[model samples]
Structures are given as C-alpha cells and as structure tokens.
Target: MSIFSKIKQTLHLMKDIDLDALGKLSQKVDLSEIMKTVGELDDRQLAGLMKMLKHKGGKKGQHKLPPIDGDFYDMALKLSPQQRELQIKVRNFMEDEIKPIANEYWNKAEFPFQIIPKMAELNICGLTYKGYGTPDENYVMEGIIAMELARVDVSISTFFGVHSGLAMGSIYICGSEEQKQEWLPKMAKMELIGAFGLTEPEVGSAVAGGLGTTCRQEGDEWVLNGQKKWIGNATFADVTIIWARDEASDQVKGFLVRKGNPGFVAEKIENKMALRTVQNALITMTDCRVPESDRLQKCDSFKDTAKVLRMTRAGVAWQAVGCARGAYEAALKYTKKREQFGKPIASYQLVQNHLVEMVANLTAMQTLCFRLSELQDEGLLTDEHASLAKVFCSMRTRDVVSQAREVMGGNGILLQYDVARFVADAEAIYSYEGTKEINTLIVGRAITGYSAFV
Candidate 1:
C-alpha cells in the first residue's frame, strides 16, 4: 500500500474510538497534533488507537516510581513555591556539583575553593540578614537552605555557616553601622569570608562566662592575646571575630582581627576525624592589635555574642536534619538496588524497618526544624528554643547515620557509597556549634530558671 493510503486507512480505523478516551490518553503521550488528528479516525483505527493507548498507559504505569526522598513529612513542600524552588535549586547544585566531588575533597581533608563562585551565584549568603547585599530572606528559608546544603555535605554547610551566619551575624547585630557597611556587603558577596574565634583552647562551653582570651585597651588599639581552637574557616578567612574578656571592663567584647595582622597566626588543626573538609584552625593572638573602630560597638558583654550563637544554633539543627536525610536517602537507594538472597534487600522486613526508623527520625527532625524556624521568624526564638532543637536533632542524626551505615554493611564505610561522608560530618556538627552537653545545659537553664552551663 502507498504511504498516504496507509495513513488514510489508519485514520479511518480510529473514527469509532471515543475521541474523549483518546484525548485523555493523548495527555499521556508526547505526540504532536494528536488531538487535532483524533477527529479523522474510523472504527478499526480507533481499535488500534485504543490498543496503543493501553500499551502506552501500561508502560507508563510500569515506569512510574516513587520519589527517592527521605523527607517523610514533605517538609520541602511546606515552603512557599519560591522557597521550594530555591530548595530544589540548592539540592541540584549539591547533587550535581558537590556530590560527585564531596568524597574526594573530604578524603583529602580540603575545601573545594572553586565551588565558592558557583555558590555565590545562588545568592544565599547571610541569607536572613537585611541589607548588605544579603537575600534578607525569612528564618524558615534560611533554615531550609542550611538543611539543603548540609544534606549533601555537612562540612561545606559548616564552613558556610561559620562564615555567613556566625561571623557575619555578629557584625550585623553588634557592630556599628560603619562596621556593618564596611564588612557585611563584602562578606555577603563571598568576597571576604569571615570566622568566629570564640572558643579558647582552655574554654569550650565555659567561655561564655569566663573566657580565657583577654583584650586590653591601650590608646586607640585593643591588644588581644589568647588561643582559639577549632575555629572553622579561620585559616583562610579574611576577618576573624575574636571575642575576648576586656581586662579593663571585665566584659566580653568582639574585635574584628584582620588577616595578616602582626602577631596573629592560625595553624591548621590536623588529624580531625569529623568535618575534615573544613579547615579548622588553632589561632594564637599574641598582642594582636585591632583598631578601636574595628570593635563591635553594641557588643558590651557575652550576652551579645550569645545572640549570634542563638541564631546560628538553629541553623545547626537544620544541618543535623540534612545530615540525617543524606544518610537515610543513601541507605534507601542502596537497599532498593542491592540484592540479598536473589531479591532486592529493600523488600526484606529488617531492612524496611531500618528505613522506617530512619524516615521516622528524619520526619521528626524536619518538623522540629520547621517549628524552630517559625519561632525564629516570629522573633520569639530563645537560646533554649534553638538549643532544644540542636540537641535533639544532632543526637537523632547520629543515630540515623549509624543505622544507615549499619544497613549497608561493609559498603557503608566506603566513601563512594556517600553514607560514610555523612557519618563523619555528623560528628563535627554534633561538637562544633555547641556540644550536646552544652546545648542541653542551655535548655536546662531555661526550664529551671537557673544557669547550669558553668
């Protein structure tokens, strides 16, 4: 038969098929001009059309698969569509750009500096702050972004959080207007990275009330001398916000210590097991001279520093959620693809139970972070509020990642499996912002109306 005649015959056969059925089926197909051409079908053509539609539907149904997400609470969906889009954008960036390179960088204990420019394009630095080239987004968006970043790699998130949230937030909240205009914009643009040097070698949680680092004022310069340990991004940051006890006033004051300052040196803290990708530094400030103008104006005591910690601690909680999610998703995907006894292990009851527990923990963490963010947005978030979320989420995340590693057996330890990285990164998160003991004490103080952190 001629080609045109065959086409005409096919059209004639389709005539008897219900156009409505064909139209409904057409929605599933990607064919061009399908509805316009449906009018020309005959009975036999319609039978053939129905057969094709059924086959297509069957194939589509067979190919349809559940999303491989660990967010059992649909936390991302809770965001406004714009926030959700931003979340997906960050996820894609992490998956496409960070995931492939994360293990390599983590193994080498090095930060991927090249990704900074790409990250800058996301326009999310200092995300919750107003002005200073910042996004000025809500706390929920900030928490979601932090979770998205850490979900792929916690080390990267920690580095970013230390720079953008802790250091920059300190300057924003306590610095003079001149200081904010001078530093916040550049830091917001990622041109100048920042670090917080609050924890001393001798003081960890006790630094708030009794910091060993002391700053003595002489003339127009403040002389700072002390040792700070586990200062994230300190080795490469442009400025380090050094919180020290002012010898004259007996109050903690923040000083912006510039990089390459005389008597200021940050040695890389080597042999770290967790968040190895972060370049934590042990900094010694021996007579480090900071100009009086560099002092954070409103930061008269430890209370101001605590405010910045309160804000960033919530972000750390979200980071824990991300870490748990990364491990859970990795384990879920592995179980589905990995076979045991000639069948996918995901079908096994024990494996399913492990996944169920991981999901349960993950869902609970997400919901808690969502509410935490809500409190933050309402300007009602307290140190205790953030501490509760941080303590709970980080502890749960450690459990989730442990289970994730457990289900994968020996393969879980391998960096290529992705769970191993989350496993390691979770440890750093648990310790960095505030250790579980410290955070719990904060909550304890709030609930009991007494300070227990000493």
Candidate 2:
C-alpha cells in the first residue's frame, strides 16, 4: 500500500536473489526497463514477484537434489532397459531382504537359508552362460548383479559368486554337454546349490603349480584325496567342483563331487573376522569316489581351471567396487548427519577431503570394471586383465573401507554402523580369489616379457 514499505520489502527480497544470476539476466533484459515496470506494481504484486524470484533464483534455490548415488559416472544409464530393470530388481532385493538381517546373521556366523528360495526367485544364477536355463545376459549385467549383492552384504555376494560364478561356471565352461544339461539347469534354478573346491591347506596362490589334492583314476571312477581349505558353501552345497592333481598325469583335473559322498567331509571353518555369514569349510576327501561321468570332460589341465578363474575374477573386482561403494555411501551419509563443533562433520574440510578421495577411487574402480566387463563381452578379456582389475579394485576397496572407518571414529568398529562390516570383509576379499601379490605378478608377467613369479 505504502511506497516506503514496498521499497523495504523489495530490498529484503533482493538479499536472497543471486546477484550473479541477476547480472547475467540483465544482459538479456534492460534492468532500467525492468525497474520501471516493477515500480508500477502495487504491494501485493511486489510480494508475489519477490516470492517467485526467491523460489526460482534465491541464494538457496528451491530445487531439491536427488540422493547421492555411488555410481558417480551414471553407468547404469548405459544399461539396456531390460538390464536396468534387472539391476534395480537385484538392488531392491538386497536392500529389502538381506540388509535388514545382514548384521544379525553376520554376527552369529550363520548363513540365512531362508533367503535361498527368495534369491532363487530372482533367476540371476548362471547369468552369463548361454544355455541350461540361463538368462543369457551380458557380462556387464553379471558384474552389476555382483556389485548390487556385495553393496548390501559381502557374505551373500560371496555365496552367490561361489555358486553362480565358480561352480556353475566350471560346469558351463568345462563340463560335457550331458554334464551341463544335468547340473547347470538345476543349479540355475537353485534346486542344487553348488560350491567350488580349489584352494588347499598346503596350496593357495601357488595352486596352479602345486595342487596337493590328488585324483587317481580307477575303473570308471576317480578316487580323490587330500583337503580343500576355505571352500565356500561346501558344508551344504549339493555339488562341489573339486580340483585335484592327476596322480598319473600330474595335471590338474576337476571333479563334480556330490554331497553325501562316503569319504567327503566338510567341517565349518569358524571364528572368522570377515564374511562371517559365509559358511566356509575345511574340506577333506578320503578316497572319495566320483564316476568318470562326473569329471568335467574339458578340464584336463590347470589352464581349464584358470579359464574359470579369469571369468570369476572380473566379478570379484565388481564385488570390490560394491564393497567400497557401500562403505563410502555409509560414511558420506554418516558424516552429513553427524555433527562436530556445532556443524555437520561433512562440512569440515578434512572430512570432505577424505570423502573426495574415496569417491575418486570408487569412480576409478567402477569405470575400470565397466571397461573390463566390456572386454569380457567382446571376448578380449584375458587372465592378466581380470587379474589387474582384481588387484586394483581390491586394494582400493581396502583404502575406501579404511577411510570410512576412520571418518566414523569410535563407531567404525561397531558392527551396527555398517562400515565396520565392510572394513572386515575387505580383508577377506583382498586375500581370496588371489592375493594382491599373486595378481600383481600376473599383471607383471603380462606387461613384461619375463616372468618374475618365482
């Protein structure tokens, strides 16, 4: 109503306007003409204009940003609509089903058997294999599924990887047509859970050259002897792919050892600090008899074993990405909500520095794995390529989870915070599949002409 009141109100509204933006707008519109037009407005019209400007161009704009996603490069946008749906489907399943009970089962050192049926419903097992009831998706989709599962629970991801990638993969890659038809379809349907037995007590990284488990062929049967350590899902897996050295040939051979074999025993390895929910077993085979038909016909040597590892190793790299992503996201969300010195800890320069480093490493790992999957789909992926990704992603994931713990302070060690679990799981991931030293040597041998593994 009054000119003075309108002038004062305009000044107050101007305080909220972004002056730089207004200056840019001035280049398009004549400021003097705009002022002349505004001068004629009554108090009500002035108030309405102020509200509109504040809503649109105020210092704190009215726009609400979507939540920060860990996939910083928007790689999911590259997925086909069908692949994208599957990715979201798996993510939601992990968040809704596994996340709630992750800590509980993890703390108790028990696998959640109830989830098997529900997880089977996802129909994601044997993801890359073309037949035997597989979905025939690309390797990228397979990697995304692995990342999604590990993002929520590394233990569950490991379980799935063992069954889907290693066990089913051995059959798909090395089994005879009859063997694949008999086993892969049921395993894909989750009717027959599978496990992989490769690592031995006396041999780990050096398993390629020194497999202690021995397989001796008899009449239409092979008798297996010696032990397998850290065999995931072995305790209850319907079938375990046992890799043993042929006593006659000295080359490695894989056998499909069914559960309930008279001489096969799987004792749960307990008291693990990492991946506690995974039921890793120390397996012993004493004269275990497997029929010749049960042997993976194509797997006559260690190179066949390496074939499976090369494929699964890439998935492990993606799992590392998920583990880091889960930790980084948890840390970022925690720092934002957590206050120190009367403001959010995330507002502090040092805290932001750590977050920036974590995100940078996370982004690098994601992009690298994406390209690695592309190579896989293109059939250009090699043992060294998978080894490089496994080494880099696993090593970086340790740093990311460590930073997550450091930012959380005292709460970092507490399992309830979620970051602690990732911190512990990172250790296991670093060692399993292949140690950093082993993987580094693989890359070393690839780039250089000489081998330094000895």
Best by lDDT: 2
TM-score of each: 0.87, 0.86
**C-alpha RMSD for every candidate:** 9.8, 11.7
Give the clash count for model 1: 12
- How well is each residue in 1-454 modelled by candidate 1, as lDDT tens digits? 3334434434543554678977888788854566445545654564466445333323544754455777665455355546766787798899899999999999999999999989988889989998989998999999988998998999999999998999999999999999999999988889999999998888997877688889998999999998999999999999999999999889999999999999899999999888989999999989999999999999998989988998999999999999999999999999988998998898899998999999999999999999999999998998889999999999999999999999999999999999998998888888877889988998998899998644
Candidate 2 error regions (>4 Å): 1-66
CA lDDT of each candidate?
A: 0.87, 0.91
The residue ranges of model 1 lying beyond 4 angstroms of the native Cα positions read: 1-64, 450-454
Candidate 2 global CA lDDT score = 0.91
Question: What would the per-residue lDDT of candidate 2 be over residues 92-154, giving only the tens digit for each residue?
Answer: 899899999999999999999999999999999999999889999999999999999999999
CA shift of 115, model 1, Å:
0.8
lDDT of 1 at 268: 97
